[model samples]
Target: MSIERTPATPDPNWDRLVADLTAAPAEKPVGPVLQKTADVPVNRPDLLGDMPLTPEWVRTPAGWRTRAEVGKVNSVRAFRRWVRRQSTEHGHGAQVFRGMHRTFLWIQGTEGVQVATARREVQQAQGDYKTAKGHHGRRLIPGKEKYKRRAEMDKAFAGSVTAMSRYKAAQRDARTRRAARGALAAAAVAVPEGAGIYLIGGTGGVIATGSALLAFALIGRRTAGGELYHDHDVKFGDTLKLTDSMLNKIYRDAKVIGADEVVELLTPCTLTADGKAWEVTLDLPSGTPLKKALTAKTGVASALGVKVQQLHQAPGDREGRLQLRVSLHLPFTGKPDPGPLLDLNCINLWRAIPMGVNLRGQEVSTSWVERSGLFGGEPGAGKSAAANDLLLAAALDPTVALYLCDGKAGADLTPFEPIAAMHDTDGEPERLLEILEHIWTVEIPRRRALAKEHGSRKLTAAMAAKDPRVNLAVLLVDEWSSYGAAADRRVREEMERLLRLIVQQGRALGIITLCATQKPDADSVPSGIRDILSIRWAMRCLTPQASDTILGQGYAAAGHNAQDILKSQRGVGIYMDGEGAEPELTRGYYYDDDEVDLILGRAFELRAKAGTLPAGSVPLADQLRAVDDDDARVLAVLLDTFDAHLDGEGEPAEWLPGSVLVDALADAGTALSADSLGRLVVRTDDEKAKRPWLGSRVVGYPRSRVLITVRDRFGMGE
Candidate 1:
């Protein structure tokens, strides 16, 4: 049993007690140095009364205000004597060690509070940068001048990103190898007299002492790596047998980088690490900037020969927090392998779709079922490639309908236009606003109505099988910040409201919205929305702050430094799934242009089999069948639709309505019309003459086809 250790509280009458103790003693002046020292024995009769009430003191004019300090000394010695007696009488070895570890960690926590400034600075810097963005609306005050302001923000952001990347890397390395010094030595306990030594030569010790030693040494060493532990002949005890000894040694020698940038022991013999945990908590050295450890972390860890996770070691509590806790899980310098490449090309879409390989080399994946996602990275940082990786998976699913959007000149998204249910690429604020409105007034309500009818919250696969309209509608937006920063006030406000609604309620209705951006700022993506994204991926972020922005707050401090990833490592990033607690460094599956064609081809085959194709969606295979069947007839009608009917005057009209085009095609002996191929793919008026505009007018991508049939299905456009 452990001894009661309730500490004595501060005296309410402290002044009176001090005065009474210091006054001209009616009995004897005990603390005259020699007087008390000579009288107090470890076994004194009043040992209990002599113990120090508290572990603090106040000074006087002579620099010795507190009286009875001498008794404190005797009290400590008497306690040690009592502990030894209890150990001998009760064998409380485990309890004694537990007390030691607890006391040591408590002391370390006190010290750790003193040296946590650098971490505080990092957190503060992150907050301040975000605050500055919020205040400026980040030059949300835009016009022709907006371009210039944006350029300036970009430049400043670049510099900050570079500096943070370096800092994150340094801090990460510092925590990886903090306990790697001190050579190991081992010896067995001494055996009593004539105890039979269980050596190779058990019975013949006196014949030749020196010869026996040589014989034992030769027999004990293993031929493979000369490892003594693996050799049965060796008598050394396993390290586990001496875990307590190892724990004490680690705790005793813990250190931090000192003022002069030198590794200084901060808790030598002052704390005890738990044997099982193998963790040390202790005070950091005074005046040592946490940066010292960050900068010299590699050298210190390498020298110490102990590889530790900086996340475990870098936490701090206060400016005066000199205390830090560190750990080397499984000890030494080993790391787990991340494993083999995961092929996600043909996996079931209902399952956790393969994302990529993570830091531990394990294949990571995310479930798209009822979850929204955020993809964050720098330009050419594999965001497009990863998005395609997702598209490949979704396309393969029978119950998924893709909606594509890109503010870029359309090159990034044009290839997949044929496959999308709703596609938008125009840089026009009005066009994007219209698309959001269509979804808000059309798709959202229809899905909600279906959910109500089915008595379901989320449209599961079973529900989708029963109702074709319950299939997943994936809305993908590229360059999201540009949409938010649009000069049009109406577009900006309305878009924000719809985006929030989609995020808040779309999951239950099978409308999953995923947006990719070059940068994630408060102004670009609302912080509130960013926090709830079920999946977050960051690849090659410019700064640790950006990494945290995508992954969540305090992610950078824990050393998930996605920003440190190099631009060259395309398709490699960190990913967090909704199901997992921790974020992981993952490399997205790489798919080239050719591979995309192949995946899309396979998706076409799968969707054809499942009969989940949207109304008027003609697959590439059907297009081939049309080529063989009614190619000539359809071609003639397509041309007839564009033939000019001078509107009572000689001037030709710029565009014809969908009903007009459909009638003209019917008159030319072609049953197919704009409704059959609508919202699919027509770029120019000249091209529309050849193919007829197949996309909706609401989302006017230069090469989009909008079907009046598809839109009017949801009560859009009258």
Candidate 2:
């Protein structure tokens, strides 16, 4: 390895090569000099031709190549033009070839200088080629082998293609064979056995013509005969010559249409089923166009008699129910005939009972027969039954005490016999009268006392619980007229006093009076009695006057009349509350004997618990009761008040003139003569005269002196 390698003698050609590479006359370096004159000036060829013929640097004695100082190289316009042309023509797509050469040189040595020199060689080659190529259109053209495989593949494809004429000819032959086979098969089945051949015209020709000709030849018929035997084809607009029976059949097949009903259909259509076609020609009804049939002359559908309504005209396939608009001729009305008012089924007289028995058209549910003193009507005109119904209701309602007085000999009041004590003519009237009097003067006070004792202000509870002597008394009198009509003047006076006090004050005391009579004349049924009755039920009376008397002007307005009254029915009545009441004909509940008995029996049971009535009947004990003289005492006081106040007359000295007591006293005393009284016109009380002395504390005024009347008898406190 110590053998020294001798340096090769420097070839004269090497030096020439180095000089040619470093200072090439063919090209110029790129960069500042080239950039300024990248477009070569046509006028500057001299700068490029006059190239320096020396190497850029030479190796000195120190064995190092020195770089030359070439400062500020001026641009040569012609050279730049030449350089630009060379780069554009050859710079692109030449790097790989240049790199290959450089790499080859580098592999020959391992010196730093060698790598750099190799790189310089690659750059110089690239730039020189770029300069030459850029001046002209220079590009690498692919060699013949570059597309050798593609050309081969294309040749193989061309060799494999068949001739177009031959392929088309084969396809045509196949199609011809298929057509021939189809024709042969169709010919075999063309004439169906026992089936007639029919021809239908096509767009240009007729179908089944061959079959018709074949049939004519087989039958040995002439062309005219075949034509005559052929069936005719029917079409639209053909007049159908149908027989009577056929017409009937067609009519029978027609759908039956309902009156006032309409059917709509899609027109200009044909029905197809199982390859058969049927023609349906439509004939509209003899009216306006269907869409406009229900429309008005104004085209607003006003003929239907409804408001302008809009309906959807959408296709029928949509999923929703269709809304139909119709204007009916009229709404519904009820016709009812008020018929006979009688029934054998008296148990529930309220049901199916005629309107006549239905109390002047008043509904039974709102009859008010149970509420006491709420009606004003005739006495015999269902008042008794209404009163009985009220009593029955009260009997059912245990809160009220039932007190019945049949002053008309207890006949009409007998229906209340189960609960109320049925009074007779024996001694009960006087006793009841006395009871009523006590109710006013004593019972009222006693009730007041009871309320005070209990620290409560209500009398019903205090009296009902504490006092057995008084039930919630509803004293019914059949003949309230009897009180005013009493033959005994004293009894009449006492009865009037009782009636006035009770009718006015009995309501809060729970004493309701239900009195009836055959007559409702002024004296018989006074205004005071009528005022208390807010309810009135008048039945068929003897006159219109009676109806008018019970019910005032509004009676007819409530649909009540005298002719429509139920004359024969037991519990029929026209009810009115007062003189201005609207009379209503309503059925008063007519409870039968058994119903009355049953209701009254329950009433009695309740009464017995309240200790209002005895639980059982007594044995045969005919005991005579003694009458109390207190009745005479009460009657006497009443008679005295009536007589003295109403009939008496007197002078001014003894009492005020026109006072009732004056008349009675005068009637009791002898009639004074005017002559006898002139002497001592009236004797002074101090000088007692022969005349029975007047029982009066009054003093008189002196003659010719006016007497002053004083309201305060003795002064303020007095």
Candidate 3:
């Protein structure tokens, strides 16, 4: 267990502290210092001048005052002591050495201060050990054996020194041998077969330590006779990017020329000749600027567009063939253009905005989830229908598999069951949660495996082509806040983890999620999930905080409301694509329930014929399958019951107790317990007098004035 520290006790000497804190000390005039020794003779003039000394005093009408006055001298001295302790403990010489340059000390018998500058008395290095101590004297030296023992000790150290030198020499010889071996290995590399090696003679010649003179060396010559360019081990179809210095020797020496003043080029070359005698004439348009001309002639001639040679001749040759070698000429001093070949294909956020999505070009649609996106808004903001339309567009693609979990039961997403794979009221919140996690867990590992197999740093073309798993899976979640609210803590944590990872890596794996929620608060949308979702699709929100939470700060400040958004109609969305994807108001694509049904009917037909296709690739039968008869019946029941309740068709019903109540609730599928029913009955009666009811009331004995029926069975009571 760790002990906690608390504040220190109050001062014990209260009377002294009070007196000293309040009272002022007597002020005295500054005085001069009487020098103990002004001139001490020393061999080093530099050392003597560096020592601290007293200065002359000046006399004034106020009295004599010393020119030097110190302030905060005690504090400075304490700080210096602390710093020295730290340096000694830490073993950093500079930490202590830097402090010695300046220090302060209080003058004795005066309330004044003195500043002193210090210089090191001894040399830091061993070579100057003797010279350094001359100023301090021999007493300062640490070890002394006297005269007799010194000779033997010195000889022993000398012997050790000799042994060290031999050891160092052996190390050097070993390094030299290693270097020679490297040179021989390099020399063994063979030139490509048939590529002639020509010796372009150098001015100087040398032999081994004891070798006789050889024949006259081969000097500079044209490729026709004995002279040839040595073909080094250049592999086939390799582009040689040459430095300017090499170009001067290669092309300038050969006097080869070409056209095009500005040559921004890259290319490869093929060797026509075998052996070192590789030579060819690259004819050029005359009077072209040598730099521009050479780029056009040699660069264009070589398989690699880069120009490797200037003149085709070897060095020292008076005349030679104009052969095109493969090489690149770097721009002298300019920024390299990183075009499509090198950089990520980032889109401009400005141009991609949907036509009416951003009224002021402020927002753009995100290409995040293929075409569809998350919709953030308040209740009755047309968020549900708007989301439906976007998903409908995505459903057009056969390769895209859409899974929508409508936590509003089936209310929000049920209309799209005809076109999209949907989980409705039939799905338990727990099962929906499980399905989401399973999709991500399986997907994440598969993506990782694909990235590893292709040796790709990310989802590159190479990996995507090889891995069938990297396909689009559009996951649509309506009212995610409700999903989280209904889920247990463990389930919520799992959802958070899955969403965080999916939002981060989903873009590369072609998996996209369109998560919609009425609540867009810090607590509702986690930080990790929000960071990667720079793309936003916002609807009208109740408050400024909610709006800003969805579309950045100041969105609600603009006064958009449900009336304004609904006026825009369904299938209309603001597009925010690319980098600057601020929320753009867009007219989203729309499809009615009939159109969606027809399309999915076709898809279902394909699915039935094809059996189970991959996640993204839906079979035609699966896409176009008719809604099952059982599902239709359940949906009809919910609609009819809710409508009847809303229309006030269900009349006032009498209250029944205990067994009677349980049986009634069971038939209605309300599933309340007898105790729960009793509590609700009591509370309902108590509050009935306070708030008038719009629906039927049942007046009975003991439990009098209890509301036996819902406001309206189909919700028309109000």
How many residue pairs clash in all the candidates, one count each? 42, 32, 80
Q: Which sections of candidate 3 miss by over 4 Å?
A: 1-366, 369-373, 415-427, 460-469, 555-575, 605-718
lDDT measured at residue 231 in model 1 versus the true structure, 0 to 100: 17
Better of 1 and 3 by TM-score: 1
lDDT of 3 by residue, 1-718 (tens): 1211322565565545344424442132122122111131111111112221212111221112111111133245445644654444222233233222211111111111111101111112222433333423445444553443455445545555555555556556555655665454333322211122223222111221011111101111122243333323222223132332233333333344322222221111221111111222333234433344333343333423232221121111112223333312221112212211112112221113222232221223334432334567776555665565445444444445567787667555665454454444443668676666766777667766776777764554344356544445677777666677788888888878877777667766666677677776755566567545655656655555665666665433332222234422343333344344433344433344665566455544443333323333442222223234332222232223333333245632322224444554466555666575555444444433322234644422122223122121211112
Query: Please, what are the lDDT tens digits per residue for candidate 2 over residues 1-718?
Result: 1211232774556554444434534454421121111122111112222322111111221111111111111124324444553353132123323433443343333343444554555555555545544433323535554355445445434433323333445456555655665455445445442133433224212234444344333433212223322112211112111122222122122322224433332222211111111112222233423232212211222321222211111112222211121211110111222222212211121112122233112244432221235333444455665665566666655445455665556555565554554343322447557656766776567655665665655445445556644345566666656654554667666766777677666655556666565655566667666656655666656665666555543343223443344344445566554344444445565565666667666665555444344222211010000112332222222234342333234422332222232343346452333333223233355433232325644333232111110102111110
Q: After aligning candidate 1 to the native by TM-score, how far in Å is the CA of 377 from where it should be?
A: 2.1
In candidate 1, stretches whose alpha carbon ends up further than 4 angstroms from where it belongs are 1-348, 608-718
Task: Indicate the residue-level lDDT of 707 in model 2.
Answer: 10
Q: Of models 1 and 2, which has the larger lDDT?
A: 1
Which is the better candidate, 1 or 2, if ranked by TM-score? Answer: 1
lDDT of 1 by residue, 324-368 (tens): 323323321232222112233344455677667643334677778
